[model samples]
Target: MDSAVSDAAVGVPPLAEPDEAPQPWQTDRTRAPVATKIVVAGGFGVGKTTLVTAVSEITPLQTEALMTEASEGTDDLTDTPDKTTTTVAMDYGRITLDDDLVLYVFGTPGQQRFWFMWDDLVRGAIGAVVLADTRRLKDCFPALDYFESCGLPYIVAVNHFEGSEQFDPEDVREALSIPAHIPVMIMDARRRISAIETLLALVAHALEETPEE
Candidate 1:
């Protein structure tokens, strides 16, 4: 579905027209930067690391270790034969959206064994980006359910991998049984601009879900 139509269906406020003057809060420079926490979660080898690295301004901290015989039977390498490393803990990065706003991104380990660390990683997160792989769409379900149970708003971003069959956002949404209000979009995790756009969408969705003071 088109973004405009999706936004309307999901109750996301439309972006202000370009000619409109900036809001007082937008123009304010005296306020201290607000730090927001965001989670980048998905299944194994679904590009969570790439997304975090692409958008972060600071050096990202990654805990990936080389794959070994220990995971021969447990880890699925059929879809990702070239994947030699696995995240043992989490990946962290930071992005400054503007002078007044910053985002702390935490990428969760894809393996179920490391999922125990997610509660701590997402302790104060405002929202999440659940990266989806068309080839392994079911892998994202756990993350999606976790965020929902925690009352954390999130947007699903389908990562486009070379040679993977392209699926429409609506089809993905239906296949995943995603609600109408949740956004589903396509993205290239390796590209900085693409990752930024996905992050912006999550931020926007989080803002909309936030109750006004």
Candidate 2:
């Protein structure tokens, strides 16, 4: 056998590995997509995760944990009987609106106990989506109050659920006592088109509220 062949037979490894190109998010600042952060907030079992999963182009990160007896009194499962898990920390996902614009979505946990994380999640966020369920409209009050107190621009998205009563946007606004200038509309979080439209509405509202430089 030749000396080179003998060396190969002795399990010698290759001298080099091919270089891999950087992903769009990891490229230079000049070429990288401009990132815009947004928060998706709502009460428990209001479909925040579903919206993020449906619209994100990349795989989403979820910190869900199976429901156990530990949450017997703390987490309410009455409206979400079929729900087997809950978001413990937060949910993260990303969507690219265009080659130059990317949106980073952060979903806050619904339970009040987890609300401490909201401050951190909304640090650099341009705006927020307060998803509401007509069946339990009161559940979203905390999210609304927090955003308002923080002076963060946000739009209310009433997620459509089967068998749930449908209300006109004006009616919803009246019920929630949302300001007239704040956008309030219906959205089906599980549908991609609906989710995208909801997000766009929020972005538009945020832009309108921003002071011109």
Candidate 3:
């Protein structure tokens, strides 16, 4: 019998393996619930789907409806009011940090009309990422209000879209009425690394909020 065939017959070993070990790129890092749940909240046209999908491991789930004049009355047409459709359901995705730790992200509807689902979506989240578009910046208030009322820890990320003017982080914080304690960061969701950095800030905020050292 051939040497390779003999090894395979005994199931002892393979002729050779690749230099790198076979492993999932995204792994569960923490055992138990080390997998934290986080919500991605924002106003319509703020790029919520882009942020989550930018770093999501599995294919992201999105419920986007095409924009039409019917929604003109329902939605608005401003610099961003041109956004027609809205996410009727949440956009869902998951990422694994290691063998035991995983992070689940749910992108909430960006429209104030969907505020009804806020409580249901944020029930067990350790924190939230509120994406904002500076063009029609006021669009983010409803989401901020929802987070404030729910008492859930959260961070705001400026979804810097093309042609949008830059603003100081402090000004955004004040405009949004974000208390000094919360961390407000900036990110361009279309970029994965930027989204990851934004997430790191959120995790840091969550850790800081944990009781007594």
lDDT of 1 at 38: 93
**Candidate 3 per-residue lDDT over residues 66-121, each given as its tens digit:** 87766766676566655656688798877655544667899998776788888898
Candidate order (lDDT): 1, 2, 3
Question: What residue pairs clash in candidate 1, if any at all?
Answer: none
Clashes of each: 0, 0, 12
Query: How far out, in Å, is residue 66 in model 2?
Result: 0.5
Tens digits of per-residue lDDT for model 1, 95-117: 66655577889999999999999
Query: Looking at model 2, how many pairs of residues clash?
Result: 0
TM-scores of all predicted structures: 0.85, 0.86, 0.81
173: Cα error in model 2, Å: 0.4
TM-score of 3: 0.81
The alpha-carbon lDDT assigned to residue 123 of candidate 1 equals: 91
**Each candidate: what lDDT?**
0.87, 0.86, 0.77
The local lDDT score (0 to 100) that residue 11 gets in candidate 1 is 48
TM-score of 2: 0.86
